[model samples]
Target: MISGIGNIYADEALWRARLHGTRPTETLRRAEVAAILDGAREVMTQALGEGGTSFDALYVNVNGESGYFDRALYVYGREGLPCARCGSPIRREEFMNRSSFSCPRCQPVPRRARP
Candidate 1:
């Protein structure tokens, strides 16, 4: 997935929430989610900007299990499942192997810590 694209999507969603006069709590929740996506995108851009170190072949420790280097996109695919950040059912995965997990009720983006 395009990092910039994902960030943009998140930002747009937050903006929509705010413009719609969503509940204060819900608005804050959206903002937090945007932050998480933005932060993740920033991390990706910074790491890949060098264009030397490929995200592939990198090993990520998920639940203490070291998953092999596949692609940076995989990080977000795990949607609609239990968010590693919060124990909430995540949205369904949009792309393969890129499950997105977040308890919109618990792990709204901004509240999530940097992974």
Candidate 2:
């Protein structure tokens, strides 16, 4: 089953799935979609396993507790850091009024989608 995820989860899932932010859903094969879903599940599973997650001190849980899951992140909020799978630095861009992060080398934009 697929559920909607926020920007943070979407970024993490895309990074895990090695999918470009500008990638068109229509161009994705079944396996790629599966990978993205799996990535999302993995993130949620890990967060649930740890009770919850907080990106910063301001992101406390309903119980007012901070979780360590933020440290396990692969791309979210990690701009300019080396990608886990590739040595390329993760880049951040303004997307839909929010930040989107990805490794340039790992998730290259399709030529048609490039500005």
Candidate 3:
């Protein structure tokens, strides 16, 4: 298990890894988990370099400056938009009173067994 990952980074990393957000963690292969962690590190590094993501004026750094990483995001908060890696549309779903964004083509949801 990992730590220090917020919702935005998690979604962005999942998108980069091409893994569905709703997939069971126990079903993930070692390589897949590695890829997810790698994606997370890559995006987090980029976000840190840019001072992090800020969608509104409420989020400001010690200097009272907003982050610019939000513009560079691939899927976070980009519902119904074209995926950066593909022409397919990005999808958003309501999760625990929050939103999760991903590329439907890149990250296909796994079928669940019927009760």
Question: Which candidate has the highest lDDT of all?
Answer: 3
Worst 10 residues of 3 by lDDT: 54-63
Candidate 2 structure quality by residue, lDDT tens digits, 4-97: 5777678888888888867777678899999999998887777666755443322444234345434667887789989989888999988767
The parts of candidate 1 lying over 4 Å away from their true place are 1-4, 7-41, 46-75, 93-102, 107-115
Question: How do all models score by TM-score?
Answer: 0.31, 0.80, 0.79
| 81: Cα error in model 2, Å | 1.0
Please rank every candidate by lDDT, starting with the best: 3, 2, 1
TM-score of 2: 0.80
Runs off by more than 4 Å, candidate 3: 1-4, 52-67, 113-115
The lDDT, on a scale of 0 to 1, for candidate 2 is: 0.74
The list of candidate 2 runs beyond 4 A from truth reads 1-3, 53-67, 113-115
Query: Against the unseen true structure, what C-alpha lDDT does each candidate score?
Result: 0.38, 0.74, 0.76
Best by TM-score: 2
Please state every model's RMSD to the true fold in angstroms: 10.7, 4.5, 4.4
What's each prediction's clash count? 15, 0, 0
Error of 3 at 57 (Å): 11
Q: How far is candidate 1 from the true structure (C-alpha RMSD, Å)?
A: 10.7
lDDT of 3 at 91: 93
Distance from true location, Cα of 49 in model 3, Å: 1.2
